[model samples]
Target chain A: MEALLAISIGVLVAAAVYLMLARHVLRFIFGLVLISNAANLTIFTAGRLTEGMPPLIELGQVAPDPGVANALPQALVLTAIVIGFGLFAFALILMFRAYTTLGTLDSDEMRIAEPREDDA
Target chain B: MSWLLTIPLVLPFLTAVAAFLTRESDWGRKVSVIGNVVFLGAAVLLFSHVYDKGVIAGQMGGWPAPFGITLVADYLSAVMVVITAITALAVSVYALSDINTRKEYLGYHALFNILIGGVTGAFITGDLFNLYVWFEVMLISSFGLLVLGGSKAQIDGGVKYVTINLVSTILFLSGVGLLYGMTGTLNLADLALTVPALENQGLVTVVAMMFMVAFGVKAAVFPLFFWLPASYHTPAFSVSAVFAGLLTKVGVYALIRMFTLVFDQDIGFTHTVLLWVAALTMVTGVLGAAAQNDMRKILSFHIVSQIGYMIMGLALYTPLALVGAVFYLVHHIVVKANLFLIAGVAERIAGSTDLGKIGGMYKTAPFLGILFLIPAFSLAGFPPLSGFWAKYVLVAAALEDQAWIIAGVALLVGLLTIYSMTKIWAEAFWKAHPEGTDPTLATLTAAERRNLLLPIGGMAVLTLIIGFFPQPFVSFAETASMQLLDPSPYIETVLGEAAQ
Candidate 1:
């Protein structure tokens, strides 16, 4: 399971990188979404995946049973997922707004902030 | 004591919510200023506590260290928190007149307060995961603050800023995940104990480099600083001042923390990489500044250049060198933030930030010109000023270490920094206004003058205080560096039971 997850993460990162290199702002944001998922999967795989077990302790007991799946990475990945969702959602809206205000999505043309001297 | 530490962290958040609810009216500005005053009091209290007790650690909900969330303040953390509160209070005052009604109604004060809280949390966090969370908090709030005005330049800049920052955040998180996989603990003190015990030191070094790149981008070091000059010059002045003062320094602070605490296993390689990165960052940043004519753009590039000096101290890793780093960090934040604030007033008076278009401030507003010279000259490392001593110690340390090349680079960068400052002094202050009108402070209303000049004057006085009374501040930084160089007190405070 760990091997499969690692390979999938590798492929996902490769695809994400390719997409992120695009000049279009919207496509770049989509690439961010893909890479953020890849990061989540990496945490999931790195924690040493275990199936069919919860990290819960028995009633009134301290510490969970041995050989149970690690719950901490699951929790960390869950939190990363939430934060990434909010950030990328904001990124998408920002790109949309940029598209409207700047009238172009091409990164090269969005140069109002740092305009070419020749243009001036 | 924990509650005292909690006040600095919690009060800004409470302020953020209150400011948000009242952002539609003048009350938002009032609440922000009051919040900053109360937060500054809390920072002073925390600093006093740290000064007396040394390193203080408090676990949330009464749980012991390494098992629960922890807030820890050593000398470095205490000083940084206090300085952050000072900058926030000054910027909040400046924003009262600088940020317009439209932006205030768009919830500017709330986002600004949240950004401050995020910076403080980043400074005091005792867990690696917690630091990343605080970084996210800083990032998201900064995103909101950066584009609050919604102008085309702002959106364009915001897009670049948000995109690059999110990429860096992912890289940071991946490093945290991989480090956790190897050590099985995210608590920093626990990691310090566990990191050396891990058999795969090679993998540990790779993870450390990953962290360096992740923070390098955020820190706006030599090759990775494009987003800063692109975005920083476009934001609101108050936004840029706070961003200038706190944001990148958080990256530097993290680098110092991780290198001193957890990543010391391979300093020969890791710090050597940092040494070269530092030199290049200095050279490239100053050259970048020389090409810029806009007031904020020049200052933004210099931000990248000045970061190299702080990193140089860290890369040297001697006790005295770290003292230089600590001193330079505090000094740079004040001077840089004050420069941006002065730029805002210059723009308001002259009607443009373009150096070619605006001039004659020295004759018309000699008061503003003098205010500009204090920080600008200080930034350029003149004697009896803060930056001179900062550079002096760093160069002295380099010479002590027989690193002549970087010593020369440090001095050379200081020279070039002066050239840029004098360019502003001559063009913005001395020359006749290209439009043939005097740009005087009298043009502004009395209230605007109060809100604007007060903070600028206050920060200038701070630069002078640090400059003239170097003994106490230098001694404080020396103590801070001693604590940084040896992390046992930090580790013991946070993981005493686990380590024992």
Candidate 2:
């Protein structure tokens, strides 16, 4: 299961990087989303998948049973997911605004901040 | 002790909340200034506490060490927090004149304070995960501040800045994950204990490189620094000034911490890479600055170069070398931020930061000229200025190690820095105004003059003080470096007897 997940992450990251290299901002943002999901999966796979019950103890038990999965990475990935989602949402809107105001989605021509040699 | 540690982080947050509540009123500016003063007081208090105690740790919510989030301050963290407060105060005062009303009602002060809070949190955090959270907080608020005006230039700069930083964030997060998988703990103190025991030292080095790239982007090193000059000249001068002072320093701080405390194994391999990066960063940054005609753009590129000097100290990883890094960190923050503030004043009087367009400052506004000279000379490594001492320490550290190549690079970079500073001085201050009008201080209204010059004068005075009184500051950095070299005290303070 870990091997399969790792391969999937590799594929997702490859696709994301390919998309990220595109000239358009929206495509680049979509690449960001894919790469972010791949990062999430990287964390999950790196933590090592286990076939076990949830990390919950019985009423009188002091800890989860010995066969329980490692819950820490899950918690970490969940936090990353939430933060990544918020940042992606913000990035989407920001790129949308850039599209509207700059009137060009092409990253190459978005040189208003740093002007090109001949243009300046 | 815990109270002291928490105050620097908590005060600005409280101020941010309060300032946001009153952001629509004129009171936001008032609250920001007062909040900065309180924050500075709190930072001084924390500094004194850390000085006396050696290292102090406070567990959040009374949880035990390595279990709950810990706020730790040794000498380096203490000094950094203190400097952040100082920069915040300086920028807040300068913002009174620089930030117009539209940006103010957009909650400029609130975002500014939150950015400070995030920087403070990043400095003091004892958990790697906690540091990531603080970084996100810093990034989000900085995004707002960067794009507040939403001008064509700002939005363009904002897109590049935000996109690149988010990529760095992902790399940082993934590095944290890979590290946790190896060590089974995320508390820095705990990781410090476990990282050495891991059998896969090669994997450890890989993760370290991940951290290096993640932070390398933030620090704006060599090839990774294109986003900085593209974006920094777009923000409000006040926003740009604080960012100039605090943002890159945080990345350098993280590099120092992890390199010193957690990833001390295989210094031969890891630090050698850092040494090369340092040289290239310095060379490229100054070369880039030499080509720029805009005042802020030149200063922005110079920031990249100066970061090279700091990282050079880190790459050396000696006791005296780390001291140089610490000293340079503090001194550069003051000098760089003040230079930006002065540029804003010049822009106010002369009407542009473009060198070809603005001039006559030495003839018409000698006071402003003097203020600009302090930081400009200091930045170029001239004597009796803070930049001199900063560069002196680093070069001396390099010579002490008998690293002739690094010593040469350091001094050569200093000379190139002088060229850029002179370019600014000659074009912006010495030459007659191209439009044939003398740019005088009187052109600014009374309130504008008061608000603008006060912070510029105040920071120039600080540069003078640090320059003239280098003894105590050097000794403090020496002790801080000693603490960094031997972080057992820091680890013990955070994790108790288990650290041993």
Candidate 3:
């Protein structure tokens, strides 16, 4: 399970990197989402996969048996997901504004904001 | 008693939410001012407590470390919190006049509060992953602030800024994952205890490199710094000033913490790389400054250069060097923020930040000129200012280590720094204004003058206080550096016997 998770994370990272290299703004945002998810999975896998484990402790268990899945990584992953969502939303809005103002989604074409020779 | 640590993190966030909810109301600005003042008071209380008690620890959700979020305030964190609070308060006051003129005042204030909250959170949090979360909070809010005005220049700069920082976040996340995977822990103090025991030094080195690259990009180190000057000066003056003052220094703070605690092995390899990077960062950043014609752009480039000095002390890895790094970090934060605020005033009084269009401000606004001069010279490492003592300690550390090349680079960078300051001084203050310029540029109205004086006066007073009686601050930094260099104290305070 751990090996499979690791491989999946590697694949996700590769895909994300490819998307990140694209010239368009939306693709970059998508790339960031993929990268964040890949990171989440990587952390999940690093916690070591366990089989047949519930997410939390059963109510009123005397010993509070240790068989439940690790909750820390899950909590971290949940936070990462929310933060990733925030970044994606912000990036999407920013990209939308850029496209509306510059009339293109290609980052290379948005050169008007670059410092011009006559600026100084 | 330990709960005081939570106030610094919670108050600004609550205020931010309040500011957001009151966006349409006329009381938004007033509420922001009051809330920030309260936050500043909390910071002062936290600082005084930490000063007396040494380090304060709070375990969130009533659970001990390794199970819950922990907030720890050592000397370094406390000092940084004080600095952040003061700068935020000054910026908040300055923004009152500045933001009222803008269309997005509410969002601006909301984002500003969130940024301060995030920075303070980052400083106080003892958990490594929690630190990453706070970093995201800071970065996201900074992104919003950078593009608040939505000008073409802002949007353009914001894109590069967001893209680079997004990449950095991913890298940082990956690093955290790797470190946690290797050590089975994410608490910094726990990691400090466990990291040295790992058999795979190479793996830890890779993780360290990932962190260095992530923070290097954020801190605007030599090769990773291209995005800074491209984006920083494009924002409005307030936005640029705050970003210049706070954002990159957070990255430097992260580097200092990580190197001192988690990655103390192979100092030759890591610290040597840092030394060379410091040298290159300083040289390239100053050259970038020299190449700029605008006042803010020049200052922005110098930010990168001065960051090199702080990292230089980290790379040297001596006690004196560490003390110097801490001292320089505090000095740089204030002086840089002051310089940017002065730039804001200069633009207000002179009608532009472009050196080509601005001149002869000495006659019209001598106070502003004097305000600019103190921090400017301080930043240039002139004697009798805090900047000089910072350099003195750093250079003394390098010489003690017999690292002649690093010491020489430090001296040369100091000279170039002075040269950059002179460039601004001569172009903006000493030269004559051309004929037929806008008559409004020659003078400021009463309100504008007052708005400008508030931040300048606040920063000038700080500069003078730190410059004259630096021993107390230096002693505070020395204690902080000692705590950092020996992580046992931090670990014992955080994880109890498990850390042992």
Candidate 4:
């Protein structure tokens, strides 16, 4: 199961890299979303898969059963997903604002901050 | 005992709440400044606690080591938190005049305080995951600060800055996951205990490189620093000054912490790679600055170049070298931030930051010229200034290592740094204004002058004190370096008896 998840992560990352290389800023945001999801999966698989077992402790038990899944990575992935979502949401709004004001999505054409010196 | 650690971490959040509540009134800015003054007091108390004690650790909710989250401070973290407060206080006072009411109404003070909180958390966090949380806190607030005005240039710069930093953030998260999988613990103290004992040491090196790249982007080192120059000049002067001084150094601090504490097993490979990156970063950064004409852009690129010296000190991995890195970190924060503040003043009086358009400051505003010279000359490594002592220690350490080539690169970079400073001096200060404007300090109102020059002069005084009296600061850095080189105290403090 871990091996399969690893291969899928590689595929997702490949797609992310391709999309992020585009000049359009929206594509970069989409690429970041894809890549962050891939990172989440990497963390999930790295925790050593325990199929179908919950991490919760049984009633009157000292701890969760030995075969239960590791809960730490789940907690970490959940935190990461939330943070990544906040960043991408902000990035999306920023892109929309850039598009309206700068009038183009192409990163190359966004030169108001660092204008070409020769033109000046 | 833990209150010493908790006060500095918690005070900023409380201040942010107050500032946000009072954002519409004049009381908002005053509250921000007053809160920072109190925050600095808390930081000094923390520093004194660490100075008297050794490495100090406190676990939240009373959970024991390697389980509950931990907050720890040694000399390095203590000094960094103190400096973060100092810079925060300086910038908040400057913001009294530089930030407009529209921006204050937009919660600028709130975001600024939160950013300081995040930087403090990063310095004191003992858990890897908690550190990631702090990075996100810092990143999100900075995103707001950078684009608060929503001007054309700000949004343009914000997009690039947001995109690049997000990528670096993901890389850092993935590295934590991989390292956790190997060691099964996210506590840095625990990782230090387990990383060397791991069976697959080679895989540990791979994770180390991932962290290096992640933090290299944050530190704004070579090949990964384009985002900085692309965006840094777009923000308010106060925003840019704090970012210039504190942000990248957080990256360097993380590099110093993780490399020395958790990733020391393969120094032969990791440190060598860092050495090459340091050299290239210095050369490329200085060259990049040479091509720039704006004052802020020139100063931004120098941030990258000076980072090379700090990284060089770390790469050499000697006691004296680490001492140099620590000293360089503190001195650079004051000098670099002051230079940006001076640039703001010049922009206000001269009506532009463009070197070609603005001049006559030397003739019209000689006091401003003198202020500029203190930080600029110090930045160029002139004698009896902070930068000279910083460079002197690093070069001396390099010579001691007998690493002739890196040492030569270090000196050449210093000479080129002087060239850039001189370029700014000749164009902006010595030359006549192309538009024939006087650009004198008298143009500013009395209140504006007080609000602006106070921080600039205060930091310049700090630079001079560090320069003229280097003995105490150098010894502090020496002890900090010793703690870094030998982390037994840190581990024992964090993990308690189990570590022993």
CA lDDT, every model vs. true structure? 0.93, 0.92, 0.86, 0.94
Best by lDDT: 4
DockQ-based ranking, best first? 4, 1, 2, 3
Question: lDDT-based ranking, best first?
Answer: 4, 1, 2, 3
User: What fraction of the correct interface contacts does each predicted structure contain?
Assistant: 0.73, 0.66, 0.61, 0.75
Docking class of 4: high
Between candidates 3 and 4, the DockQ winner: 4
A1-120 per-residue lDDT for model 4 (tens digits): 888999999999999999999999899999999999999998888888988998888899998888789999999999999999899899999999999999999999999998987776
- For model 4, what is the error of residue B46's alpha carbon versus the real structure, in angstroms, after optimal superposition? 0.2
TM-score of chain A of each: 0.93, 0.93, 0.86, 0.95
- Model 1 segments beyond 4 Å from truth? A59-61, B497-500
lDDT of 3 by residue, B1-500 (tens): 66689988899998888888787776676677788899889999999998988777889998889778889988889999989988888887777666753544538778988999999998999999999999999999999888887888788878889999999998898899889889988888888878989999988888999999999998999899988998988776777778888899999999999999899897878989999999899899988898888889899999999999999999999999999999999999889988988888788767788888888777655666788889999988888898989999999999999999989988998898888889888878877765424323237666666666788788888988888888998888889889988867777878876658
Off by over 4 Å in 3: A55-68, A116-120, B101-106, B436-442, B497-499
lDDT of 1 by residue, B310-359 (tens): 99999999998999999999999999999999999999999998999999
lDDT of 1 at B124: 97
Q: Comparing 2 and 3 by lDDT, which wins?
A: 2
lDDT of 3: 0.86
- lDDT value, residue B478 of candidate 4: 99
Q: Give the per-residue lDDT digits (tens) of candidate 2, residues B144-206.
A: 999998999999999999999999999999899899889888899889999999999999999
Give candidate 2's error at residue B167 in angstroms: 0.6
